[model samples]
Target: MAETRKFLSVETISLIVAFAILAFAGFVTARTEQQRRESGAWVRHTLVVESALYRLDGAIRRAESEERGYIITRDRAYLRPKDEIATQLEKGLAEVGALVADDSEQAERLSELRPLIEERLEQLQHKIDIMRAGDFEAAAEIVRTGEGKALTDRIDALVAEMIAQEDALHRQRDLQMSEATDTLQTAIGSLIVLIAGVAVLAVLLTERQLHALRKSSESLKLAYNELIAESTKRGSLEAQLRQSQKLEALGHLAGGIAHDFNNMLGVIVSSLNILRRKLRRNEGGLDPLIDSAMDGADRAAALVRRLLAFSRIQPLNPEPLDVNSLVIGMSAILHRTLGAHIHLATVLAPDLWPTRVDANELESAVLNLAVNARDAMPTGGQLTIETQNTELDACYTDENPSVRPGQYVMIVISDTGVGMPPDVAAKAFDPFFTTKPIGKGTGLGLSQAHGFATQSNGHIKIYSEVGRGTCLKLYLPRYLEDSEAVEAPPQPQPQPPEEEFPRGRPGEIVLIVEDDEKARQATAQGVRELGYTVLEAESGKEAIRLLRARGDISLMITDIVMPEMDGARLAREAVFRRHALHVMFITGYSQHAIARDGMLDPDVNLLTKPFSLAQLARKIRDVLDARGDLPKGKP
Candidate 1:
């Protein structure tokens, strides 16, 4: 028995486990490396194929364009680019052929694509040759036959097929790569778990042996220590894995919903504008109806904004603000919204630090929190808004990895309503995870608040119990540098009367470029009514042609999103030609254009969609009135 036990001793078992781990790690590394090489090849192949397809399309288009130019202007110089583009296209196709040499199916597709492109190019060349031969009528007849267009369309379809194949191949390779990565992660995780389990098992077996052999107490203690250490490490790793999974799920949700919602909102906003205008022109006594409609539209807009915030897609226009003052200013609105049944109070620190944040977004976040509290208390409750200057130390940051250790302005909203249970409170920040009945609440309030705080380099947390109360704390980083100076409460400026507002200057030709017909005509009519000469185009390309044909244009008011050419690109081209051209961008919704990540460009004047007629009038007046000497490309 003693001889048999020697082979199963703890030291021997440890050595065997160590060798197993090393061998397993080596196997995983080799497999991962092979998959990586395969993935890289697929990526390169896809890129080369895509590049060839685009070049082929471009070359075909150029040949047709040159054919038209020679036919129209009878200039042989137009034919020069055709040869050059063809040469480049051949080189691109050669590259793609080499890339797909390993895939027979794709190579066959490439084979089909090359001939179609050549055939189309040859047809275009034939027309040019005929035109150069002084048979203008024959060339014109050939062009009229539409044969070149037919051939080019066939070439495009073939190239698209080849591209689709490559894309499918790329997706396949990506899926394989993902599987490899997941496998590697699983192997590594399993290795760790195995090591911990083996260590615990060895310790247990060793302890049992120690007791049978009547070994020293110190030996038993050592074995127990090993088990405890492995268990603790395993628990930590599991917690981290769960956290990573949660974040990945949240990212998927954010990406899935925002774009479609924004587009629908755009249609709603534009239709609303048209309705409001028609109502104003006639005394339909529909003022209340319009106002009510506007209110609902505004509320819908707010909901969209909140969704954007939760997704972290909402851009921020941060400005320095005194924390106490911002709260004080909102106190009145907060009280009104809270109603008489709920008591509102503020416990602001006199020396609270100022912070830089998007004032409107911050105000919205506070209001959301208040509204959420109101819902929680149907029978009435005390609502307190408190602000304090505080510092988060290393100890706090260590536990909350998302938070930074620095000076922060803490805004706490407390309520005496029935608080959330521990389980409910845990998931309070998840987007659209609401507890209220249908149509009563959007689970976005807390999520948006959380997103805003984090994006602004701050943090947020919640504390609640089943019945006692609830408190939500928002930690926003305090401004450490020069900030907005504390000033006396501002006096409300009287708005200019309807007739007092600036009107468009006479003969100041304003170009309106908008893709939506309803939106474009509405804008054009509004500017024309303002006494300015207005030129309207439904696309950016048309606007460009107009810009070139007319030099009297003083302002270009364009929607940032359009087909063929976007407003920004148009403005850039227009500005390049006319450096003093004034441009204004308006958009209903976009993740890009005139703004990035919700922050508006200071250099370009911007007006959001669903704007009133008065707002448009004032913006145009302001742009035209300003010294037009600002640098170009600023938009």
Candidate 2:
């Protein structure tokens, strides 16, 4: 078998060398032509500028000469020539304006020149008009005053300055053109020598390149296969990474919810056990233990509400609140909360602008920060709570991509304590990511605070350095009034009730519609204990049927979340049937289900779930008593 040859033949190598020489000559020729064109452009531009200036100067001089001729000889011919010269001057000015259009400074100079030349022409014409009217003395007096001479001299100076600028430009362009010509000539000679050298080297370089290319082609094929395998691995890893992240987020959410719920349950269980022991011992009052349990339930409800807020299911009901007033009101509680070990200070900014936010949530967030700060300062430290009206400008919003550029009311809480390290600080706002010992912290404080701020269209920033200190800044959007300042709400005037709330009458009826039988029975029992006749139904449709049949039913109390039909729809139908029927909504679902945009309808009453027996009594009594005041129609 014969081996295949790799290298090119002598004749083939010669052909490649010839092609290299031709390519080199072509490149040199193209470069030389480009340089010549560039030089020509520069020279042409310079000449255009120079010629425009020269024409302008000439028009000015001719107008001045024509004026002088008419003034000295009093000849009409010289005066006739003035109009034509004026037209020429206008054209010259226009030409100069066009020439310098690209250069702002020169264009501005041209603008000044036009006005100066026009003013000089006007003066010349003024003198000529006086002479034409046979007021020779006046014309002679004007010329003697040197006013005409001064105006002409000013015009001359301006034109001369413009011409000088053009001349300087022309000189610079000429030098460039000269250098380019020299470069072209030198490039041609160098390219000839380079072409011969390149032709000789082409054969040698081609042999080396062929060998290198063969090796590179083989290497590329191997690299391509490796790349495909690596890409497949990367794709699989990415899929795994995405799944891991989703699971991690789910865990964080579930863990945070369980942690808070467990704490509340602990309180309730302990309180219940204590109350039972006391009952067995024949204790007089178990109010405190019962109250403890109620408190736990309330906290659990609050946690649910906050979670809804974090999910953006519960809309915000922002009202104009004075930051200074809020800070002052919370100072007492903050002082007590921080304990005697830590010194609490309030630097309330006077006359701070009002901000729009949910006051309850704002208070909770502030309190959370204070508590966190207190925990940080175990031994003793200073905790400062300050409020100020601030503006988050474009630069700040740019750096902080989450923030919007606007006026904000800033609440800064700073603590001098053992600060968090960088890693802890970074994850401080991540749910269930706590640095505290087990059971010490829920880790939802900062996360809840962050959620509140973001949901309010505001921003919160945490600045902490290990062993230095920590500062939590909460920025809420400012409330702007269109015309007058926002007036403070009038204080309620004390008034006695018209009459005592009578105990439930025999005919007074309260209908309780709840899907869950246990909840339904408990609610009915609460209403019955309140001295009112109770009617029970397991669904909205059942309650509506009962409402249609019973005329004695004074009020309808229904659960907001139920199967088939909701309390809202039930209330609508019941109210339609009985125009005077008063309705109250109870809900275990999120506020969004029972309320419109987080605000209970003004005409419709609401009672949140997990209420104690006392709360249920009060709500039922209130709705029954207000029966006469309810709107007599569907709402």
Candidate 3:
């Protein structure tokens, strides 16, 4: 064993020497590649210079040849060629000088060549002038007797000498390039042998690593498979959870719609019940019966209004309104709506700043919150709607991403009932997210309220504890504006028992454009029943088609939101085509779109939806009657 080990020393020394030689050879080869690149660039530049030199030489030759031809022919055509020679020769001299400018020896030679060339050019010019002046023999003598030929000879010699010098320089460059290329090839050959040995060693190392990696790969794959399986199971569970949450939210939203509908029904039934009793008592006056019917009509109108608001048909018109007035006005209705069981209370702060918000939407939101609070109570609890002033700052904005730094009117609705947990409270603003039992809510109330607040440039926050009551803070930014000079509720107008309209002339035409199918049909029915021609369309498309089909449509009623064309556009087109056509814009979303378009005439009329048979009759009568004076509804 000792002898065998001792023999390894010589082998190790030989290996080390071999590695040193390989490294030295590789270093030389790499240096040669850089040298080859520089040499190639230098050779390319020299070739470009050589080409330019040849161009300059060609120009010189053409000039000399043309000069000789002019002297022999004495023709203007020959003189034309000679005339080009001086310009060409000067240009050639300048070009040659530029080419050799970078080389000291070549530059000195160019300097010598320039003057000789210029002297010959001057002498040739004089000789050509002499010949042109009819002293042809003297010019011929100058050419033949070798008077100016001395200068020409000197210039031609200098050019030949310069070209020879350039040729020699080019030959030298080519030889040096050939030697560099051969040396580079020899170095590259040695480098390739060294790299081959290194590749063998690298392959030996890679095989060991590959064997180790293959052993661990199987274990990793099993673990990864298990992880993927577990993840798939969790994903399935999450999907099921989401589906449950969605269904629950739908149930809540459905309930809210039903609750509002039920309240409207109660109003109609109770008013009729009172009227029935009064009639049974043999009441002589018809005032009670008349009032009860009006009350029922109003209640039905309110129900439709709420539904439209929920369906996003109603537009939100934001304005500064005192929250105190809004709450007080709706407090009585909320009490009736929430029922006698839930205690509805208001805590309106004195001198509360008016917030810029949609008054109608805010009232609906308050009612929605109150109903939600009542439901959470289950039995009976105080549902307090509190209003206060709030001043937010950058510090508060940092804490709440949605809340900006500003002053706001905070309207909080609270209930002392089974409160929501943190998780439930956090998701309160999310549309269709609810904690109520099925058929007890329309998850939209809270979401609608939250959306209303946000759309009004306000913020909504929820605070709740499990088993404790929850408080909702709605922060509505304040607006600066003058308060309205509102009057007391006016006395009910003494309306006619039934409406009647005089028959119009046969040529009188009325056009109606409205978007809603049911509303359009109902409006058309009301107008037709009242003895006027009626046309109905579900969208702006049918209305425009009907409009284009006939010139007889005297009154046009179109919906504000139709598929292809909105009411505003239809109105504009109809009026432009027929100056006599009357236009009225019916819109469910008048809040966002009411102000725009040349569509509606200043005299054109607008009527909100869910209108009754009598209301429709009255509006049409009023709109048509006002048309006599070109009231806003007519073209």
Q: In terms of lDDT, which candidate is strongest?
A: 2
TM-score, every prediction:
0.36, 0.44, 0.32
User: Of 1 and 2, which scores higher on TM-score?
Assistant: 2
Worst 10 residues of 2 by lDDT: 489-498
lDDT of 2 by residue, 245-277 (tens): 989989877877787898999999999999999
lDDT of 3 by residue, 488-579 (tens): 22122232344443444335555666544565666666666667766676766677788789977777766654546656666666666777
- Positional deviation of 340 in candidate 3, in angstroms? 10
Q: Report every candidate's CA lDDT.
A: 0.76, 0.76, 0.68
Q: On a 0 to 100 scale, what is the lDDT of residue 402 in model 1?
A: 81
Candidates sorted by TM-score, best first: 2, 1, 3
Model 2 regions more than 4 Å off: 1-194, 199-225, 269-283, 482-635
Model 1 per-residue lDDT tens digits across residues 413-475: 877678887689999998877888844665788999998988898898786655645778888
Candidate 1 residue spans exceeding 4 A from truth: 1-283, 286-289, 482-635
Report the lDDT of model 2 for residue 229: 99
TM-score of 2: 0.44
Better of 1 and 3 by lDDT: 1
